[model samples]
Target: MADTDLLKTPLHDLHAELGAKMVPFAGYEMPVQYPMGVKAEHLHTRAKAGLFDVSHMGQVELPDPNAARDLEQLVPGDLQSLEVGQMRYTMFTNENGGILDDLMVFRLERGLMVVVNAACKNLDIKHMSESLTGPVISHDDRALLALQGPSAEFALSALAPEVATLQFLTGKWIDVDGAKCLVTRSGYTGEDGYEISAPADQAEALARKLLAQDDVEAIGLGARDSLRLEAGLCLYGHDIDETTTPVEAALTWSIGKRRREEGGFPGADVIQKQIAEGTSRRRVGILPEGRAPAREGTEIQAPDGTTIGAITSGGFGPSLEAPVAMGYVASEHAAAGSAVNVVVRGKALPARTAKMPFVPNGYKR
Candidate 1:
């Protein structure tokens, strides 16, 4: 709420020293952009590498051997199938089958390492504690740093040579800048990268080391938004929320075949029904005809003036050099190339539904 009450990430001073313009986000004072500007920072990541301070996100540990089985009660992912060191993306759902929060679950040797959104982490923890068995541990002393782009491997390998062995959606314990850290060869920026969870005390030092490497720029929230938007990734509380089902979000793929058939998770019945019968609306990408970006909440309409949907996330894609967006529209209009119009400032802008990841994903399989 108040600026004085905002939480500071471990890299706060580093961000300030790098000339970042700070703002309040999810109860934290974070860098919105640095001196290089959002556009330059964005292109830098696409061309080289960008370092992001995502410590605001929550990290939780489920230490029980039955964590996977316990997890199936909350989300639809096939967690029991995950091998050691592998990671999967899924979401927490409400009883109505609407998405509560999206998260990444890493099956480590001892337990499960889960990373959730900053805005929803608290509720996710409470929900998990109430539903799962004992001992849900929160990592308040950890900081997460995302090194993303083509050079991510090259830069990160200098510190943790073993990191190069990790494929996409995999993680392992490693020493980064001499700090015992959990390094994952995974990212959501549609680029090759790693997410490092390091001790808070050692975070700044590790971040500085990564920054010292060639081709790594300190990125802030401004570019982060554009990068994820271009990548067609959903932002919680915007593109998805308590009212949107996984099927409606086009995220049915995250549901494992067994889970889909068994129908054991919260709202699984509703999700199964949606899987058999199509949902009323589905998420899809939209490309505006011109440079004027269709921002979130902009109403989407059919060519004949019938309202079809609204833009949940929209912005100028530095990599695509065009305005890219994703939103939900009636299932009939969700098909790529379907004609649509985005109402921005009471004027209709010609647009069309397009495929996601407006920028091609570069993840290493």
Candidate 2:
């Protein structure tokens, strides 16, 4: 894409003024890190607080009373059961049970709010519009920011005291320094944090206000990726894709029981069958034996040197101070603690199957 066509978030200039290293990601010129680098940013966030600009994600609203029913036809989550001001992580599946994209749905008054990956937002919106009969509106005027870490609640509480009361997976409208915004008690870093959605025009002001807090520091895409990886969260195009089913991705929990029994969502038959019969391959966490990080596309091999699967997402965990990754392996070899090998630079790196969330999640609820 041309440079002019690259999308810029409301805080683009602010990132530049802060001496952040810029990189193209999801068609947006985003900050990869500041002068302190990814490791420092990562550690800072875990220790205190990190502010991240995630405005590249798509913000959309469904404004019909039947919106829940309309959305239920696309994703596997039980939207109707989601109480107002609550959020749920869900997936858009195809007819074959493979994921189109994993997204967050927030139950709001008079409508449902959705946040989707930027790369697949257009396609996702088009598909949803074609499949549902509701009035789907894309909120391009909004921007998203994530404030994460142990001190996140305390820092954000200074601006919106009510935000501190929200539990994990719950959200509500709040005023941040006089700017109206939506705050969700959820994050990708396995930390007790909030994701704020506000008008694009007010995003920069909100970010600055949050950073003014003693505990909050500006983070970038580099640390954000590492944090999510350490948390064992799936990235859209990597850990999950059109070819990966929810069952195979180890995200079957996202499928509501009612949806599974009702068989109304797309690919319900195939997904329900996988739930019953099991999938041939399953996504599992892996921990390599040394400091050497495993990168994507690394071959995961059985002890016998037989290729079993490939690494989807991998990186050095700043918190664990070790190399960690998540990938699909044959069902027979998917158990935690199972011995495996990751081919790194043509050399077999000793690795072992590990349980997810390499670091424990610190959500309040």
Candidate 3:
């Protein structure tokens, strides 16, 4: 889609003023890079702090008194165990154990707040409404921003000192410049960071204030993609989809022990079975030799050229300074250090199965 035809976030003007290269993503016009380029933007965030405008993501509230109990029927995560002000990364599954979408669930005082991919928001909302008795409400009047890096805590603490004391996967309501906001000690970059959600009208002002900090700089989608790749996080349509099972996607950890044993969520039968018997194929990390980068749709082949699986997501890792990717292969080929060949751009590039998180995550515990 063209930028002119896409939805614009509240920070659109700020991005343009910063000389960011705009691109169409998930029905929104977002910045792919600034004048500093993707590589520099990525490294700067790792060393200091990078602010990202992710307001295009969908925020929804489940207002049922039994919101947690109702949500447990959709996802396999143990929502009941989630303490107030804590967050959990989980996925929606279909009847056959396929992943519908991945999301973040925050346990708020009055209700449950969910952050889902923009493209999947409508379907997710519809599904939730039909599946549960809870009242589903989408917050279209909000904007989200992520401040990430080693110095992220310092930058946000200057405005909300309480944010600095938060541990990973926790959240709190705070006052940002006198505006009520939700600040979560969570991020996609695998770094110590905060995700702030504020009223749409106040977004630009809050962004400008954060950017004014010495350690903070505006970042774009290009660097954001690379950072998540290095963190071993899955991008919805890429690494996982309706055809991928949580067990097959190496996301069995997201299934809490209670859900695993009780089997109440959608696809609980198949998912629980896979947990016990193991899956036929599994998502694994692939490290291609040399400088060649494997891309999506690349075929994974055995030594004899037998096709096993396909690449879902792949890109250059700025933190590792090498090319890395994730793909699903047969169980036999999913072991770490196993040799495989990825057919990238018509040539079979030598690749080895490696452990995930190409770079170590520095999230504060």
lDDT of 2: 0.92
lDDT of 1 by residue, 147-215 (tens): 999999999999889999999999899987699999998876889999999999999999999999979
Score every model by TM-score. 0.99, 0.98, 0.98
Q: Write the per-residue lDDT of candidate 3 for residues 91-198, one digit (tens) a residue.
A: 999999999999999999877999999889889999998988979999989999999999999998888888888999999999987779999999998888999999
The sequence of per-residue lDDT tens digits that candidate 2 reaches over residues 88-118 is 9999989998899999999999879999999
Candidate 3 — which pairs collide?
A: none
Candidate 2 Cα outliers beyond 4 Å, as residue runs: none
State each model's CA lDDT, in order: 0.94, 0.92, 0.92
Displacement of residue 23 (Cα, Å) in model 1 is: 0.7
Supply the global lDDT for candidate 3. 0.92
**RMSD values, in order shown:** 0.8, 0.9, 1.1
After TM-score superposition, the amount by which residue 280's alpha carbon in candidate 3 deviates from its true location, in angstroms, is 1.1
| Candidate 2 vs 3: which has more TM-score | 2
The per-candidate count of clashes, in order, stands at 0, 0, 0
